[model samples]
Target: MGKQLGFYYNSNYCIGCQACETACKNKNKLPVGIHWRQVDHFETKNENNDRQVDRYISRSCMHCKQPACAAVCPVKAFRKRPEDGIVVQDREKCIGCRACVHACPYKAVAFSNQAVKASKCDLCIDELRQGEEPACVRGCPLQVLKAGDLREMEVKGVVKECQGFLKAATGPSIRFAPEKR
Candidate 1:
């Protein structure tokens, strides 16, 4: 891959509005029951146990370096692009076997009954090629989402993991700025 493309989310700034999810669905023309992006809200007690805290997380395909979906697909429908390292699907080659759906550790892959194929976030490659941000990133009212080179985000001290997310051993491309208590 020429560059490691990825996204970043700051939980501290998220308002749990689901605007990113809505933007993703609208931009991709997703059918009912298929959500490429989702927002999760959870509550936790502070360390002092005096008050409860709410956290909002926006989640999508991480486009991992060692993508389990790509590894498990028998037909090789999933591929990591050499230009930017975005994991994308070749729908014409897919068999609708659901192997990718099961293999993704972040549960990013989804089965589309209408199309009879596995689908997930491709990070809006078309938009990126046009020098535009992904729909989800652009749609965040709170500016909680960002897209850029993974190395750059790491250099800015983005967190690699947080609650309600899979471990980073698969080398997930997304980074988190988790809420601090």
Candidate 2:
């Protein structure tokens, strides 16, 4: 939409804390098993130095440039706003088909068992509409989650490529910057 919708996560600052996850759940009123955001851990060993290093990857909907969730949705519940490029779902229009769930490469989309409909982070649109940060970003203790323009944030070393195929498939708008040694 306004070139102002996106997120940047710096693993260096993330600390594997689940604060973001918890905040999203609380703000959305989601149950225990549902996670709008999840953290991934990557570990590597340096044989020469005899050291083990771990990297934390915090992931959620990238709200792609071309979201598969919107593409496969049968009822057109998922929509991508052209103004700021934000993807959102209309709860009233959803049919609980789960097609979007299968289409999402990052598995960022999920079907809510309680609601019997597909659900994912709407990037806290309600808060953003009021000029506030998403709940998860605001609640992150380490400030790992950030939302703003991708171009501007990238310059601050807070953005990076998408983790895998989702990067190529939808060109996810959000970026990540892992911690440095």
Residue pair clashes in candidate 2? 1-83, 1-84, 1-85, 2-83, 2-84, 160-176
Cα lDDT tens digits, model 1, 1-181, are 3689998888876889999999999999999999999999998787798998887879899988989999999999999988788999998999999999988888889898888898999999999989999999999998989998987887655678876665667889988885577
lDDT of 2: 0.79
lDDT of 1: 0.88
The window of 10 residues in a row where model 2 has the poorest summed lDDT is 157-166
Which numbered prediction scores highest in TM-score against the true structure? Answer: 1
| Model 2 CA deviation exceeding 4 Å by range | 1-4, 46-49, 156-159, 162-166
Best prediction by lDDT:
1
Q: Give each model's whole-structure lDDT.
A: 0.88, 0.79
Per-structure clash totals for the candidates: 0, 6
Q: Report model 2's TM-score to 2 decimal places.
A: 0.88
Candidate 2, residue 73: lDDT: 90
Candidate 2's displacement at residue 117, Å, is 1.0
